[model samples]
Target: MSLDDKNTLAVEGGSPVRNTLLPYGHQCIDEDDIKAVVDVLRSDWLTTGPKVAEFEKRFAEMVGAKYAVAVNSGTAALHAAAFAAGIGPGDEVIATPMTFAASANCVLYCGGRPVFGDVEADTLLLDPSSVESKVSPKTKAIIAVDYAGQPCDYDALKKLSDEHGLILIADACHALGATYKNRKVGTLADMTVFSFHPVKHITTGEGGMVVTDNPDFAVRLCAFRNHGITADHRQREAEGSWFYEMAELGYNYRLPDINCALGLSQLKKLDKFVARRRQIAALYDSAFADMPALFSLAQRDDRKSSYHLYVVRLNLSKLNASRQQVFGALRAENIGVNVHYIPVYWHPYYNKLGYGKGLCPVAEKAYEEIVTLPLFPAMSDRDTGDVIKAVKKVLRVYAE
Candidate 1:
């Protein structure tokens, strides 16, 4: 396993480390999950039923939030949260460019402007000082993303939000089980959002939630997910009244009961899933600790990440090839290494909207070197070994 082993790289017409490609992430479903969905299918109510409330209650309690509203997807949850925050035309929200476009697109959905903020050089999380510099009278809120399941520096972000009278939104879509300064992510912001996408810590096929301590935000979130209605169908039926009102414009972002049932079943196994992810991350951390050409992201001691993604940054200065070449080498080795993100503003649509390069220098540079490795609860020790061996092999070949 030494660098002097003289093994030819798979991309250089040699045998691959594995015959099959190992995906970066995947869902782990079991019999219980299938049974939950089957039970929901057999029940009288399907879409808007008791399972939704049950799932919401369990999720809110798990994260120590006072309330939770279920939505169809993570993007929908963000949009509902932004809507509840009262974002409108001419309003601006400070957000990090080091995340999925949805993090910033949610603000646009509310007819608000998304101001890009730079990230910390080591952690890739939003820089509080940069956020402060972006703040203005038109800035209505700060959408602090919990990048790669690690909570942002919320204490500092909260201080900035308070000073500017801005609403603080935690885009904890990657951080459902994470903690910051001993507080769960869902309780750390004015409103917190979580996703149950297949690749996330837990899955309900495709669902999301917004948790908050503020009852006003909770009510608004509930209404926004149901087409801005005063009451849902169940509420109307319970009251024996057919009357309802659409007080404000909203989207049909409700999560179906079947999905909630599956989510509840998956929730029961979330801690175990997260624990396995952490175990894999630890293995990666140890494997790359002494390797000068590659390193894991900086993690603060005071926080715990759910490890939704295990990303490593390549030291291009020590490598003879570009990030693309190394990425291709890994892929050739049948290791499905992928990039976490390209800066949100660098996209063509955002560019068309006047967002140009150099908006967030650190994020832009980090994007060139960061690659996501295979990680999931279902991955075995042998699979992990294969990934490590492949990475070391590829990096060694390109190492200076």
Candidate 2:
């Protein structure tokens, strides 16, 4: 079982490093999480109830935000935030292309255009200078994605937003417990969005939240998630009235009480979950620090990442294989390595919109080499070791 043996490369008909595939990400559910959901199921309220409010309150407190609005999914959260910011026809929002399509698509949902901004070569974060260059008279806001769970340079971005009189939104779905300059992510931007997908730091089955200090944005968010209604059914019942009005068009994006209950329970273990993710990331960093075939994404000294994805950039010049070849080899080795994203504008849909290639050179280049590794709280040390060994073995076999 010598890792140095090229004949052991799984892609070459040799045995894999591990018998079972190691997923890039997974959820860690405990008995306590089950009990919380069961309690909600046993209760009378299932949809919108006290649990939703409780979850909102606790989550806001956790992130140091003055208000929180829970929604059905991260996409809904982004749409709600865009609506709250008053994005409309002819407006433009600057966002990095190195993120999930939803980050940019949300702007299109509100009848606004999403202008692609380049990322830094090392960190893959939205480059402030690129954002500044993209700003125009049509620019209404900036959606800064906390790619790979690390916070962007908020100070630089905040100054740019203030100078332009534009709103700053944080797509922090990957950064639940991350911090920037000792401040939690939710408090950094004008509005911060978090996702509770199973693979995220916490799970609510399928839920998301938007935290903001602005009461106006909070009100808009609440209304937007519930068909733009001024008051919910509970409020009407409490007032002994049956009448309600939809002031504006909105979506049915309400997150169920059942999901909120699970989120509340998961929230209790968020710090622990984040700590384990960071530990796993540290282990990977140590193992890959000297590996010439690849290098991990850069981390800033002032910000701490929750490490939702331990992504690495392959040094293709140092190896004889392409990223696709390496990716396939890792898969053959039972290592579920994946790419975080394709440049958003490169998608067929966006391409039809006349967004040509080479829009964001740095992001487009990074996409060609990046690979996401296994990173989750439930992974044991041995699981991490298997990933490291498999990656090293595969890359070593292809190294020039």
Candidate 3:
């Protein structure tokens, strides 16, 4: 579809731009996903039932983890992991600034400080070198983010964590299906969290899960997500008992069985979805190769990235339009392009906490150039071509 074709969908010609909006990512739900949800709705239990445990088992097997606990959201999963790792008020957890807010926010929810670690210039995953440099006595964990669905250098990070006696966390929200050195992502860290929000590789209609190999940590996570009760609420209710002991303080972060059913069904199709996404990514990667005004994020041949976002770095000096301008211009052509993130510190909330700008120079630098192109399993080849053409048309004219 060309700009001229997209223009037909426009409500007004005020900007002579098309109105066909393309979002950066979306869920590729199928009839099976619908059927799964419908079945759950018809089941006896709606929340935190057998289906939740099923989903957890399925996901755990998929990721090669020993245990999994479902949560209401990715933030909840992170918070649970942090608490299980024993992060607290005065502790600091190191993480990259390029990730979604939940990665860092999880630490805050547990009353811990999120110390910003710089990202690698190419992959945008947390740079182990920078993380090592930033480590202090207060640092209790390293919340490594798998930016753009690429796995972070977990082997190197593991070594550092072992030496420092720090908990290594995998904020694997973006890289659920990704691999590192041929090992599954979830098994790479002390605790790995997955997100099933609408835009992720799979969705539970807004849910998350935490997976860990440590039996003790898994127990803590399971307990923390359910009001710190040792027994399942459903089990107690079935036993005609109202009495349940609260072993510790916890939150109502339990993921509903209804939602978990959706996750299970969605997981079945995950490989196919990832394959399609990779197909599109290959096309775009080839298209952007040797381009003057744009560069693709670097990847490791040995690693399998889930490709949650197909991000490109803008060569601003060669372009006439700014990053914002390019974004507007793409949307004008009915192509949905978006910025993946701003540095976490740049947000007003972080600013109030004395997290000043320039804290991680590489992250701030990447923020200026990074743009997430529209990529989803359901997108047709035509949609892919449209995005490619729209990008070249809008960006080429501005290129030096």
Candidate 4:
């Protein structure tokens, strides 16, 4: 069909993308997932049980990390990692503002200040140079997030951390199945964190993990998750003693056995799930290749993304419609579109903490045009086609 003919028809819009609705993301749970949870329910142990250890061990092996500590949520994992890294009062941790608030909040939880850094304009990943510019004498750590499942430029980040004698924490919450320079996300930094929320690559209802090669950090993480208690109940009973000691101030961040069982089951299928997500991303990339009004986040050559979110940045200057209008039009066509983030520092709480609009110019500008489309393992080919059609229609109708 002629380009003008296609554009005209789409603007008139006789048919919507799909007859029904599709959420931005959804978990793919099967019979095995249900059986795993049921098996845990039938067992004697629920929280702080053998299943937790099993999940940790298996996950560590999968990611080529020496140790792994399971936690109740991604925020808990980040908090434990930050605390273990010695982030406290008077310390500053550099982090990208393009991620969820939890990434920065973890530093606050440790009584440390979070220094927001601008992101790369094309990749939307943390800009290493920007992070270095934010570093100061009080800087103690760099929490680099694997935004949109793409690993950040770790080599550059590590160099900055080493130069400043700072800890490097990989917020791999969106990048469990991702790889950087052929290494898994879990082993990329000093302490790597993963999330098992329903929208992530794997789901334990709501759980997370911290993986590291340092045994000391693993021990600290364990204690931090259990209210700084030295020994668990099972360990005390096995030693023929009812003695446990509180070593430090910690939070109740332990993941339950039921959730671990589900996590373990989900881990078995992570490779497949990531592959499907990548396929969906490829389809989107191909469909949008020639579209001038939209561009997807750039993937780096040194890493393989897990495709946690297929976000497209609209070229608002080339379009007659604003981002909000296009987003609303897509939703009106049953295309479940959403924005990935509104810069972490833009939140009211952060603003109250003295962080204002100009914290990160790149991130602020990106936030204005970014739109997250429906991309999940459970989405079928037909479903993907619907999303593609819907996006094209919206852009066509709004094209300058």
TM-score of every candidate relative to the true structure? 0.98, 0.98, 0.95, 0.97
What does candidate 2's lDDT look like per residue over 1-400, in tens digits? 6655655787777888888999999989999999999999999999999999999999999999999999999999999999999999999999999999999999999999999999999999999999999999999999999999999999999999999999999999999999999999999999999999999999998999999999999999999999999999999999999999999899999999999999999999999999999999999999999999899999999999999888999999999999999999999989999899999999999989999999999999999999999999999999999999988888888999
lDDT per residue as tens, model 1, 1-400: 4433447888887888999999999999999999999999999979989999999999999999999999999999999999999999999999999999999999998899999999998889999999999999999999999999899999999999999999999999888789998888898999999999999999999999999999999999999998999899898889999999999998899999999999999999989998999999999999999999999999999999999999999999999999999999999999999998999999999999999999899999999999999999999999999999999999988999
- When superposed on Cα atoms, how far off is each prediction in RMSD? 1.9, 1.5, 2.8, 2.5
By TM-score: ranked, best first: 2, 1, 4, 3
lDDT of 3: 0.88
For each predicted model, how many residue pairs clash, with residues at least 3 apart or on different chains? Answer: 0, 0, 0, 0
lDDT of 3 at 256: 88
List pairs with backbone clashes in candidate 2: none
lDDT of 3 by residue, 21-111 (tens): 7677888888998999999899898987899889989999999999999999988998899999999899999988998887898889889
Q: What is the Cα-based lDDT of residue 60 in candidate 2?
A: 100
Off by over 4 Å in 1: 1-6
Candidate 2 runs further than 4 Å off: 1-6
**Which consecutive 10 residues in model 2 have the weakest lDDT in total?**
1-10
Window of ten residues with lowest summed lDDT in model 4? 3-12
List model 4 lDDT by residue over 171-210, tens digit each: 9999989999998888779999999999999999999999
Per-candidate Cα lDDT values, in order, are: 0.94, 0.95, 0.88, 0.92
**Quick one: ranking by lDDT, best first?**
2, 1, 4, 3
TM-score of 1: 0.98
Model 3: how far residue 390 lies from native, Å: 0.4
